[model samples]
Target: GEREQVDFRTSHRRKDGTSYPVEVHLQYLQGENRRVFLAIVLDLTERVATERELQEAQRTLSTLLTNLPGMVYRCQNDQNWTMEFVSPSCQNLTGFSHEQFVETRQISYGETVMLQEDRQRVWQNVQEALKNRQPFQLSYRIRTAEGAVKWVWEQGCGIFSATGEVVRIEGYVVDITQQRALEDQLRKTERLAELGTLASGMAHEIGTPMNVILGRAELLMRKAPDERTRRGLETIVTQVERITKIMNQLLSFARKRPAERQGVNLEVVMLDVLDVLQERLGKQQIEVVKTVSPQLPKVWADPDHMNQVFLNLILNACQAMSDGGTLSLALHPIDDTVELIVQDSGSGIPEEQLSKIFDPFFSTKAVGEGTGLGLTVVHGILQEHQGAIRVTSVPGQGATFIVSLPIYSEEVRHEA
Candidate 1:
C-alpha cells in the first residue's frame, strides 16, 4: 500500500493518566510483500499554552482600549491622516465611530474633525518631534459632529522604520475645552486684579485735582459777565464733570467692598430700574417687554449692587438702539440659580469685539458717551457675587446678555 502523508493535531494521554497536546503525522508505505504504516507524534503542550497566553494578552489590550477615556489612534503619515486603527472610544471623543476612521475610511481624522487653521501647526510640530526622536504634544481645537468646537490635547510619537523613516503615528486624544476655558478665566482675573491695584493709585492722585478743577469751574461760571463768557464757563464745568465721572468709575472698579448680600427680588429691582429709565425710554421711543416667572425665588445678592447691575444693563440696551427698538427682559429660576436675560433689538456687537467687551476701558460707545467701565464693573460685581454673565450677538440683528445668580437660601444667608 502507498498513501500520501497526513498530519493532524490532537491530544494524547500520558501514562500518568494526564492529557497533553500533540501533533500527529502519518504516512503509509508498501513493502515488497507487506503493508506498513508509520506514525509520528510531536508534543505541542508548550506551544498550545503559549498561544493561550497570547490570546489572553490580546483580550486584555482590547478591554483597555475600549474603556479608555480618550481616543487611541494609529494613522499613516499622510495629509488626510488616514487612520489604520482607532479604538472604540473614538465615538466618545470625536463623535465618530471607529469604523468610520479605520474600516469605511469615509472620514479622515485630519480632514474631518481637526480644524483647518490648526492642521498646519499640528503637522509641523509632529514632524519636528519625529525628527528629534521625541514624543509630541499638541493642544488644538476641533469641531465635533454636533458642530460644537472643543479643545483637545494629544500626545503621541511617530512609529519609525529601521531606516529612520516614519511609517505611522499612534496617539491618544482627550477633550480639554473646559481646562482651556478655566485657564483663560484665570488670566483675565489676574489682569483685572492688577488693573484694580493700578486704578486705585491713579484714582487717588486724580480725584483731588479733578474736584478742584470742577469747583473752580463752578465758581467762575457764577461770575461770568456775558452770555458768551457764561457759555465758556459752562463748557469747562461740563468737561470737568465728565472727568470726575470717569474718575468715580475708576474708583468704583478699584474698590473691593464686601457685598451687602441679602435675598433680593430681581423682579422688583427690574421694575425700579425701569421706572428710573422711564423718561429716557419714552424720549427714545424704545418699547419694553418684560417677562418674570410668577413664583421666582429671590436671588442671594447685594440689593444696591443688583440695582446697579440692572441699571447698567438696561441703560446699555437703551443706548444700543439709537432709533428705538424693543428691550426685552426675562427672569426665571433655573435649578439652584435664578437667570436673567436682557435682550436688545439694536446695533449688535461685532464677533471680534465680543471677547473684549468686558475688558476695562473697552467700549463700543462714541467718545464722551461712555466711560467704558460699565461692563467691567458689571462683570466684577457678578464675579464677586459668585454669579456669571454671558453675551451673544449678531452684527446687524441684536444682542442678548444672560446673567445667572444663585438662589437665596437660609444657609447661604447665614454664611454670608
Candidate 2:
C-alpha cells in the first residue's frame, strides 16, 4: 500500500512525553495474511506557528491600513503607471475604488487624475527624484469624479532593481484640501492684520479733518442766506456724512473691535433691518418674505453690531434684486447655534468671485457707487460676534447667505 493523503494537524507525543503538532500520512502494506500499516508523522509545530504569526501580522497590517488617513499604493514607472497594489483608502483619496487601479491600463495616474496644470510638473518631480534615487514629495490638485477640485500631498520613492533600473514606485497620498484652506486663511489673516494697522493710523489722521468739514458744513447750513444756499450746504453735509460712514466702516473693520454682548432676538433685528430698508425695497419692487421659527433661541451678540450685520445683509439683498425680486429671511436653531438665511431672488454671484466677496475693499458695485467694503463689514461684524457666514449662489437663480451664531448661554462670554 502506498502512502495515502496526510490527515490534517494532530498532536503527537515526543520521546520525552512532550506533545507537539504533527501531520500523519498513512501507508498500508499488503502482507501475507496480516496487513502491515506504516504511518509517517510530519512535524507541524513550525508550520502551525508560522501560520499563526502570518495571520497575526496580516491582522496588524490590515488594522494599520484601515487606520491610515490616506491611500497607500505601489505602481509601475512606465507611462500610465499601472497600479499593482492599492490600499482600501484609495476611494476616499481619489474618489475611485482601489480595484479600479489594480492592474488597470485604461488611465494614466497623471493625465486622468492630476489637474492639467499640475500633471507635467508632478511627473517631472517624481521622475527626477527617482533618477536621483531620492524620495519625492509633491503637493498638487486632483479633479474628483464629482468634478470637485481637491489638493493632495504625496510622498513616494522608486523601488529599484540590482541593475539600477526602476522596478516600481510606492507612495502614500492624502487629501490636504482642508489644510490648504487653513493656510490660505492664515495668510489672509496676516494680510488683514497689516491692513488693520495701516487703517488705524489713517483713520486717526483723516478722521479729524472729516469731522471738521462736516461740522463746518452744518454750521454754514444754519447761517445760509437763501433756500438755494441752504440746499447746497445740505448736499455738502450729506456727502460728507456718506464719506464719514464709509470711514467708520473701514475703521471698524481695521480695528477689530470687541463686541458688546447682549441677548439679541434675530427676528427683531431682521425686522428692524427691513424697516430701515422699507423705502428702498418698495422703490426697487423687492418683496420681503421672512420665515423665523417662533421657538428660535436668542443669540449672544452686540446689539449695535448685530444691527449693522442685518443692515448690510438686507442692503446686499436689495442691491442684488435691483429689478424687483424676493428677499427671503429664514431663521432656525440647530444644536448650539442659530442658523439665519438671507436669500435673494436676483442675479447670483459668480462661483469664481464668491470667495473674494468678504475680502476688504472687494465689491461688485460700480466705481464711486460702492466702497466694496459692504460684505467685508458684514463679515467682520459677524466674526466679532463669534459667528460664521456662508454663501451659496447659482449663475442666474439667486444668492443665499447663511449666518450661524452661537445661542446664548451663561458660560458663553462676549469674547468667545
Top candidate, metric TM-score? 1
Best by lDDT: 1
List per-candidate RMSD values in Å.
3.0, 4.4
Off by over 4 Å in 2: 1-9, 23-44, 103-113, 143-148, 210-246, 254-257, 292-297, 332-337, 408-416
Model 2 lDDT vs. the true structure? 0.84
What TM-score do all the candidates reach, one by one? Answer: 0.87, 0.80
- CA lDDT scores, all candidates in order: 0.90, 0.84
Whole-model lDDT for model 1 versus the true structure?
Answer: 0.90
Residue 7, model 1: Cα distance from true site in angstroms: 5.6
Ten residues in a row with the worst lDDT in model 2? Answer: 1-10
Q: For residues 230-341, could you state the per-residue lDDT of candidate 2 as single tens digits?
A: 9998989888888877777777756655677878898998888788878989999998888988878989998888888888888888888879999999999989999989
Model 1 segments beyond 4 Å from truth?
A: 2-19, 26-38, 131-134, 226-236
Give model 1's TM-score versus the native structure: 0.87
